[model samples]
Target chain A: MGEIKTVIVVERNYLMQAGLEAMLMEIPGLMMVKTFTGDEVSLAGHIRKQQADVLILNPLALKEDPIVFLRKLKQIGKMVVFGLMEKETPVNLQSHFSHVLNVSDSKFDLQNKIRSVLHQDTRPGNHNLLSKREVTILKQVVLGLTNQEIADRLFLSIHTVTTHRKNINRKLGIKTVSGLTVYALMNHLVRMEEMGGATK
Target chain B: MLINKNMKLADVIHHDYTLVPVINRFGIHLGFGNFTIQEVCKEHNISTGFFVIILNAFHDPHYFPKERLQSIRLNILIEYLQKAHTDFLEDKIPEIAFLIEKMPGECLDDRKTYLLIRNFFLEYSTELKNHITKEEERVYPYVLKLEEAFLKGETDADIKKQIQDYPISAYEAEHENVEEKLFDLKNIIIKYLPKPKSDKLCFQILREIFSLEKELNEHARIEDLIIVPKVEAMENALKLKGFGNG
Candidate 1:
């Protein structure tokens, strides 16, 4: 068995919370840590203490502003949040979660859902792997072109170029020009000779 | 754990030793064997409420009581933020740079890679320095001056001219994302650094980078949560009073 991934369910509906908990137990390597009605005072404080790996929150059940509360929870540390969506939840609140699970998901569906999230969490390449567009932008970046110059060369709008550049930074996790240049060199995205002008 | 005034200073430090540097920033030195938080603050001539709030906010990211912070004087917050900037530039940045500088010597085979990483850090340090300089030289003074005019319910022509030329909202809009580079630097080191002879120095560098990143985030949060909104409110109030040309 792999490491036990603890989970906390915060749903206002007792039946729904119980059902989620029961199904989660059927999945190997997952431990149901706690369940909250979501209106409990200092739920944030309680949840912080529990130190669970995954928090399954029904966004509508949160007494405090869900967006702000979830954001704070995220800032606390690495916890994968799965929104327990029973009905229509606002887009803003839904954005806080990594994935959403329907109230009616069966045990098999639930197992798959948890597995995918856990896999993504533990997977190293899932985060830093650059998309094709990101690689193109990164190439332009290492070539020592300004945003405007890149935009012109690539026939992309300046806004698109900037967004792509930001995404490249986020994907590769290398920020400085030299850092990115080194990454490109290591990955053979560009040769050492290609970066001589920009790196020095 | 939430901090309160009546708790013993020693116990508070025990609760989160990371707060030692935080309290130190407030000029509260160690050696009080049994001073309560309130007593310590009183001795230091610091507002107990403000001290408690700053400690809690630093200890717990979610603990920021926005209303409580907004009520305090902006200059107090600015002064604290300025101290954080000074700490970053003078202590934290140099400490990290020294660690990175040691890397090339420690791993001669990967000297070029280490040097590239060092250069990246140097560039980031320069950017951070410039960002801090802009805040200290321009943004902080403008905010202090704005607060003075707001408190007096009057703005002199000079203050008005400053506002007309560059409003507080303008500063808020162009607040550079100075911390983003640190995120990238951390990722590069952790994920892509060529195999080093020893992981010891890399571990230390990553630790310092993480600490600096956390502190930088908190500093940015203070400005976003407290300074910007208060300044914007004051700007609106001044405008309503016919203080500056829109």
Candidate 2:
């Protein structure tokens, strides 16, 4: 039992919904938050209001424009989804859902994908996350400067420079100097010619 | 660097020992006298196909086609991915959060900044949940529907109309950028925050973060290398069936 993830099943079929509930019970770390029938009014509104983390859905519930409803969910960016369609429905769900599979996909697989979906290492928010000094350290690191050299050039302590280097790695999600160089290049913090012979 | 059919699982583990975690999920254990790779896997009910693939991958990570990911049924990869996620959400995330929470009490001087570190962790965890939720909720379900459609050789007009506005290409476009706040949280702990009085606590937390980072990197790899490619293939075939966003 880990951090519990609440799941909601949205579908039109009675038997399939019941089957999903039973299957979710057997999967550890995934608790059924609720089950919604396709005919339920304001279905999207209900999903928006729930604290559930994942939604297993059948497109038949929405009838006319399930994709439009999905686009709204995408825009909302709350409560991830699983598209549950009849085993024979022809649709390319790639563009809209993180994962799409037939209603007939094994319970074992449904549970597994749900678990994977819950655990992805998503990007962080508040775009301007790094500091001025940290950015400087990142460029120097990409330029192949050692902590002592960065300290000498910046008039900072060796310990402080080391701390900045560690922070830069954490903030940017990069570990290697080469990786830092790539990040620097991508962000236009440094130019190709400016890269130290380390990359040449 | 030679690989022979006769190579023992015990021999490989003894040589690098670090290989334990790589194959540990398959139930391969230590204390074996002289069992062949196939022999032990058979005893544990592990797929010999998956086990052999792991062995080759360990030998050369660049080994393309990753035989098991290619040769086995798609369901196998899906199952493996599920288990990986379960380990992450249930075990890793909670453990990291717990460790960060312990820091403030352990180091009083570091208390003020420790609060920031813990808060950032909570924020990262929530966003991670959002990321996972988006995929689980929409993306994976879409892929499953695509598979079903492919098998049955048909798709509905409604879905085709919806895909015109939202395509897999768009989702793939946004998946590349790394999680930003996560790095900030780690750095906040490493540089911005005051050091804990107990070096032991600091090391323990760092070790946990490192492992979490490692596990996540692998999870991303499976998605990018194994799962995405499979879905892309199915998507392409669907387009050929005249369901092409027209």
The DockQ scores of all candidates, in the order shown, are 0.27, 0.02
List chain A TM-scores, every candidate, in order. Answer: 0.58, 0.55
Task: Tell me how many clashing residue pairs each candidate has.
Answer: 0, 35
Cα deviation at B186, candidate 1, in Å, is: 0.9
RMSD of 2: 21.9
The residue-by-residue lDDT of candidate 1 on B1-246, one tens digit each, is: 898999998999988888887888889888989989999899899899999999999997656687799899998999899888888999999999999888877753566677677777888899999989999999999999999989988888887777778877677667665665777787777777777778888889999998998798788668765787788788878877865343
Displacement of the residue B23 alpha carbon in candidate 1, Å? 1.1
TM-score of 2: 0.49
lDDT at residue B14 of model 2 (Cα atoms)? 70
Report the lDDT tens digits of candidate 2 across residue range B1-246.
Answer: 433445787787776664565565565557766987777777887787676665555554334344357555555666565665666677778998888778867753644355445655676677677777777777776766766776787877755653555656556656633345555445545544444577677677778787766666556655655666666666677677856544
lDDT of 1: 0.80
